[model samples]
Target: MEYTLSPSVTIINNRQVLVSSSSPSPANDRRRRRRRRRSNGILHFPFVFSGLSLRFRSRAVVVAGAGSYGGYGSGGGSYCEFSCLNTPIEPATPAGRYLSSVLLNERKLFHDAVAETLEKLVKEVDEAYARKALTVDSSEAALHRRIAELKQQECKTSVEDVMYMLIFYKFSELRVHLVPPLSKCIYNNRLEILPSKDWELESIHSFEILEMIKEYLTFVIGWRSDFSVTESWATTKIKQANLCHIYTTSILFGYFLKSTTLRHQLEMSLADPIDDIIMNAYICRRKNLVFGHTHNKIPTSPFDGKRERENLVSYLTGFTSDSLAKCAQPNSKEALNLITKYSFALFGDVGSDKMISTSFATLKRLVLEAVAFGSFLWDSEEYVKTVYNLEEIN
Candidate 1:
């Protein structure tokens, strides 16, 4: 398929979402044309919208003019569509016109930007596996080969995808989910996502994971103009744009973890039932997903490696979110882009400087949801690619 990028269009989730008023203001029209503002791969909508989103995400991946992804089966129920959409899609304070604006060539920009960031990060990670490799190319090849040829067996996937998963393994080391006693019903007699008040934060990643987080903190957050990140990131007012950046990257982080964990499980599952004990041990739980008051609807973390595969498979077979279908598909490319780009729209104008001074406790839920969002995206992108051309299809 062939597509064109237009400076006049707003591309959300890889689909063009054109927003225009039925009528144009004579005063505004009379104004002289000016150069469009530079965009940082984030779009800003100035007017009121019921939340104008151009992407569609349901229970499973659907590849139409949009795309559909096949979900994995976990012997469990489905999650609420876009349960990961923790915030509204409006600007923080609103500033910029939609037309006459362009994204910073996110497709090519993403790869180059990540390569530059990873250049500084690769040194801190344990490269005993790569024989002291320092650049992304050498380290990526060695790491991808290791995952593909585990236990003397082979699996096939793009080296780029594998590289992303491996790069993130060390850069961050945290995940979030709600504690047990997930109540399915509330005073309104409807299913609602539990608030951050009930969240449980865990930092039990491997020694390597923690070290990577440290390296990233120093490289990325150690010198920010907005706020500071100490050994413990204290509760302070933070820039919405920065939070949006973190939000987008966290999704990629979890998505990579989910993908790597699933591939690793495929290799280990065939080796020995005894090996399962260590690899498949419980990780963390994601508070995203809607349950039918059933005991098994809760989803296991992708890191768990024991049930995410099964959970994803079940979604393919028959899991669904009817009324919410258009709003979710946590496992699809559209959903991935939808959630990732959401950061650009959440506060102020596109890349607005306004800060979301909300309590740290309240924002934690959104942060965790972003990670869980990526995990599901991996499942969607992973399974959908088997039948669809896949690879973000941009």
Candidate 2:
């Protein structure tokens, strides 16, 4: 049987989507309400009243506090990063729920606990380095020292929450700068978030790092060959569950872009015309190369004879925050060590059954936010390491 929904309910039907918060502010995602077009006093959305089941959230929305910081952009200067720290945030929006890990915290009035929590997680994030830095070679030793000093105003490095808040704030700023006009696709009058100028502009990525990305963005927009590369953008109906995978993949793509860009810049500074950036990029993406592994074999197909569950990590590596540092280049092995253990896991899984029809415009904003996120992470990785000794600066 076919179903009909208003634009709002239609958008919410996409199931189990995930983070990104590419809009002007995390606050903009705070409360999403689907307009129920009343038809004879009954909520008209068939999805809501249908016999098919839907998940309901039990816990009150609670987000961590992002305290003030002087170095970076105001670290959630308002104290509440997602919604005043301790109130319901977007119970209706499936996409915002994937950030549960980043935003989930107790109902506390102050953000001090979050800082403390992040401080403790620093060692956990760098556990491998902490355990092996001294025993390893000079290179790993150097990376440990570098991560020891990675901070902004000491507080950012000391408490990653400040940095996290800064990234959130930064993306909000970009969303304003990169507003999208209504799509020109007559059939796809549905709104998206990137500008009309960029709709068919080929690429939004920087030239310095374009080759390295090599369809890495397949996770976000799908294979370039699958659609008109410069003539038209495709639309997909993403289930909320699948949305989490896409958002996380986009973030990973951002991280990869930054790491490659830095590696390129570093090579340029060396005054040598190295021709293996993409080679190093491929080396960096190898799952086996994680944590100083010397394995250099190309990863087998995501599923080699075995079912997807057997190759789950390899399969899902492209879908979650677990692959942040997996793109370590052969030369700069410790490129991502400073922010190694960081993750973007946030919010509860609330909309497992919903799905959203993602437009090219929405995809555009998501890409913009991701690149911005990667840039900030790279900056923090450099800043935090610029100073050593991993002590909390409270």
TM-score for each model:
0.31, 0.37
* Shift in Å, residue 190, candidate 2: 9.8
Candidate 1 regions exceeding 4 Å error are 1-194, 197-235, 272-336, 386-388, 391-394
On a 0 to 100 scale, what is the lDDT of residue 154 in model 1? 12
CA RMSD, predictions in order: 23.7, 18.3
Top TM-score: which candidate number? 2
Best by lDDT: 2
Backbone clashes, each candidate:
24, 32
lDDT of 1 by residue, 1-394 (tens): 1111111235555744333221112332232112113333211222211122334332332211211111111224333222211222321111110100111223223333433323323322233334334433774776655643451121112222322222222222222222111111111211223344223322323333333333222222221123333312333344544544545544554554454444444443434445444343322112111111222122333344553343222222242223122322234443444454343333223344544333333334444455555554554344333322332433
Off by over 4 Å in 2: 1-61, 64-158, 168-205, 210-214, 223-235, 271-325, 328-353, 388-394
Q: How far in Å is the alpha carbon of 223 misplaced in model 2?
A: 6.7
